[model samples]
Target: MKRFAGMLLVAVGVAGCVSNPGVVKTGPSTYMVSRQGKTGFAGIAGLRAKAMGDANTFCAQQGKQAQMTNTSQSSGMPILGNFPRADIEFTCVAMGAE
Candidate 1:
């Protein structure tokens, strides 16, 4: 039973892992960030928040500000292998540039 319990624990831990691919450049000055919530209870809002944070951080690293261009999210049923996910598109622009 102990071995079964250990395996179950490991599975749970892996199930809760969040998948985030940092900012990806899609075009000149434009980037995209995507995040997935693997757990059943993970919500779309949380995934979007994390993606937005990642995009902002990436822009900050370049001494620019992130201006969001588009945002998308999908609600998923984890039991069916679908996981909540969010994607955000943004552009890094000079400070005060709209």
Candidate 2:
């Protein structure tokens, strides 16, 4: 029983050293805007809100805009977030209006 527990610990450690194995690429692509927001106001009794997706597109359709950011890969993977494309996220934020 002790030997089995030791083997389990070793396996868990090895798994941690392995890279993420579930990220999928949609082919040469960009970051699809996952969400959107807006703010405004009218009279004290008025209200403001944001609409998702392009109004020219549709209300039922989800909102999304693709901004090409991912540009490289390492170890046969697109190192997105803290790994490869961290800058892309920052750049994307800069593109948005404050």
Candidate 3:
């Protein structure tokens, strides 16, 4: 029983550490990134920061800049199994291009 309990704890820890999926191309030059809070204390601000960082990295990789189009976040009740989350929509544009 102790071993089983330990295993379960480990599993839960791993699940909480799960990372956000990478950015997705939604349309021409437009992309989206999303992140879920890892724990009850994790706030939407943290999730949004992570997502924005990812978007910037992705655009940089393409030799472009990230121009945010829209952003949304939900501060769900983590106690009820609804964790905070954030989604960011952006477009990859040239350094000087609108």
Candidate 4:
């Protein structure tokens, strides 16, 4: 029972560390997508991809294509394991009227 409880606690902690990537409107025509994870260069790239993918998906749902304008990353608190993060900014480009 003690072992099971410890495992459960570990799982919960890991779950909390999982990044939930998503998009948010930052301007009338621009949107921002972001994600955070514990990784180095590859992880940062993956997060950037995830952010861009989310932006593309968001624009697609609005009958448009993502026109990525900029990309960024931040090395989060090193004391907290350097949780790297990535963000992408984009505007929705028209794909013709639906």
lDDT of 3 by residue, 1-98 (tens): 99989977875776567567889989977899999876667778878888999998998998998989999987546654356789999998888788
**Measured by TM-score, how close is model 3 to the native structure?**
0.75
lDDT-wise, the better of 2 and 4 is 4
Pitting candidate 1 against candidate 4, the one with the higher TM-score is 1
| Candidate achieving higher TM-score, 3 or 4 | 3
Q: How far does residue 8 in candidate 3 sit from its true spot (Å)?
A: 9.8
What C-alpha lDDT, on a 0 to 100 scale, does residue 52 get in candidate 4? 82
- Model 4 TM-score on a 0 to 1 scale: 0.69
How high a TM-score does candidate 2 get? Answer: 0.21
lDDT comparing candidate 3 with the true structure = 0.82
Give Cα-based local distance difference scores for all models.
0.82, 0.27, 0.82, 0.76
Q: Which ten residues in a row have the lowest lDDT in candidate 3?
A: 74-83
Candidate number that wins on TM-score, 1 or 2? 1
Model 3, runs deviating above 4 Å: 1-19
What TM-score would each prediction reach against the true structure? 0.76, 0.21, 0.75, 0.69
Candidate 2 residues lying further than 4 Å off, grouped into runs, are 20-98
| lDDT digits (tens) for residues 1-98 of candidate 2 | 99989977765565445442222333443222121111111121111111112221331233433234433222223221122211111112222434
Could you tell which candidate, 1 or 2, scores higher by lDDT? 1
For residues 1-98, write the lDDT of model 4, one tens digit per residue.
99989977765675467675478889899888888774333477887888888888898998899988999888555333356778898999888633
**Residue clash pairs of candidate 2:** 53-63, 79-84
| Candidate 1 residue-wise lDDT, 1-98, digit = tens | 99989977876777756567688889977899998877667888888888988988888898988999999987545654466778999999898899
